[model samples]
Target: MTSNSPDRPATAHPGTPVRGRAHPPRHRQGPSPEEGELLRPLTRRQIADRMGELGELYTRTTPSGRRKPPSGRPFSSDPSALLAPSPQARSAAFLRRLAEHMRRPGFELLVAEATRPSGATVLTACAYGFPVLGDDTWWQELDGHLPANLPDLAAPGGLFVIGDILVERRVRTQDQSRDWNLARRLQKRLLSDHTAAVGVTLVDRGDTDTVAALLSWGWRCLPSADRRLLVLR
Candidate 1:
């Protein structure tokens, strides 16, 4: 599914077709809190499928013209990339929809971003009872530098051990072999320490390999899911 409308001016008529805006912001009405909890403990494949659906929804509603390649293929520098009227709205809606989907189950949402604004938006959503974890330069840091200060998610009874967890790992570049390796290692470590449900969001600029590697690490692949995680090298 994809959207083809253009960006709407801030003061445009309410009835105007907004480029990336969902008619009612799906989160406004989603699964009840109890249902969210029930959905929280879903398998990796389930979570991926859910996220994929949200992504499809975003693409469906986002104007094709706005899908421009990044300058020099660099990560988008504009904060609006994560929340503006075009792609931002779709992205925000994706987060909101995910939150709503997990709201009923009280699943904790962990979003890791390469940029500050993306993390901020995810954290903001997390503040509403969703569990959020983030790192600035997360991709760079995860590539080779494992943080000594990293939280002990594996600690028994730690905050990291939450039923139904969503971990978003956003990638902006193609040279992510080291990062993928580290992420797989970390996932192995986390699985050993915690029994809570876990899922990952391998957000990429366009390189499917990045997402593919992440999924192949341990996450059960779901054809129904849109994102593909490749096995880390």
Candidate 2:
């Protein structure tokens, strides 16, 4: 289903067709949220198909998607930063990642997708988010990655956790005048910082675009794991 949202300026990328600016800014409505997960790991082809849909969507929505890496190959502006050599490689890598994370009992895949004018569904963004229902031992696996200062998200009563978020570059950077539009929509219905907190692993060179928004929107940040894991409560 489509989400009923305020009109958003239509954003076009390299491969997408552009209309005359003489016509006025077009309105692109935001998409509704989708909540589901791959119950198990996917085969290489299945992963490729899933990622191709997201790649096209990412490329179509963001202006930066127009800028290709030196290799002259296309890549999704986000998540591929997880260190795959190419978009195709990223698909296989993501399959492995989903396998590791989803196999755990509590994690879920949360995505928001919209339909393009051509009737194709584009994934606007995705987050590895869910309730923290596992035991304290879960922290043991992550202990080596952070410093001692991280907040305890697995406190007695588990909290809702947003492990990672990868948003389509265009939805985030499309309208600079309203940089937070996409962020606002996703967080509004999903977060209650008082009881829900998000944890993210940040390397020194990664995209920190959403960090400022997370903090400015009232999430208290606690740095840990040699400052690698940033927990927002």
Candidate 3:
């Protein structure tokens, strides 16, 4: 049931050719309100097979903000911080990270697609992450210490890490009315499976816009050791 999308930039990962972006449905005209999106969980094999599509999506959503860590810091201790790869390398780096993340037990991915009046489908957004192990081994990657309660929260295995959330650029443009808040919706749906778990996601210490967006969406900032990373829950 793989589908392809049109209208995205033609960049692709080195060895993996970009075989058309996955549209999920085509953009239609008229004042008709946008339809609700379908959200579904993806198995590891399904996600691996769609690397080409996901890679393109990642490249399209790659943040264009500053890649450097705060002054005097060497990019938070998080291995996920790789100075925001150049446009040419974003696809490859993203795929590599996705591959690594898939190896973790309980890792999961969810994708969102919308149906147009013509009945075409368009891939609108996606989010993925896994439960934080009770051992707290994941904490070692942070550049700073966590709040006192964070460990206690994770101790019970009631913590989940949302690694990434991405929405198509056009979706945002078309959603200027704020009616959908698709990104927020994607996150909420993704976290629903964890039921009451304190969800956390890391943002590059320099990505102020994303941090602010998270805040607007009701996420709280958890203090860390330094300015290299901001943990939002």
In the range 1-233, model 1's lDDT, one tens digit per residue, is: 54445446778788776566555433333322221111112343555655654454345423333344554775467855644356555666666655564643234333222224344312101111222244323224234333332323313222232222222333212222432433333443443334433433334335444345444444533221222322111
Model 2 regions more than 4 Å off: 1-84, 141-153, 174-180, 192-221
Give the TM-scores of the predictions, in the order they appear: 0.27, 0.49, 0.70
Residues 100-215 of candidate 3 have per-residue lDDT tens digits of: 88888778898887787798886667888888865756778774467777767777777788887776655444543353567666666666777636788777656676676666
Clashes found in each candidate (C-alpha, N, C closer than 3 A): 19, 6, 12
RMSD of each: 20.1, 13.3, 15.0
In terms of lDDT, the best-performing candidate is: 3
**Candidate 3 — what's its lDDT?**
0.69
Residue by residue across 97-148, what tens digits does model 2's lDDT show?
6556555555555456666679775566655555553354545545555443
**How would the candidate models be sorted by lDDT, starting from the highest?**
3, 2, 1
Q: Best by TM-score, which number?
A: 3
Off by over 4 Å in 3: 1-35, 65-84, 116-119, 169-180, 226-233
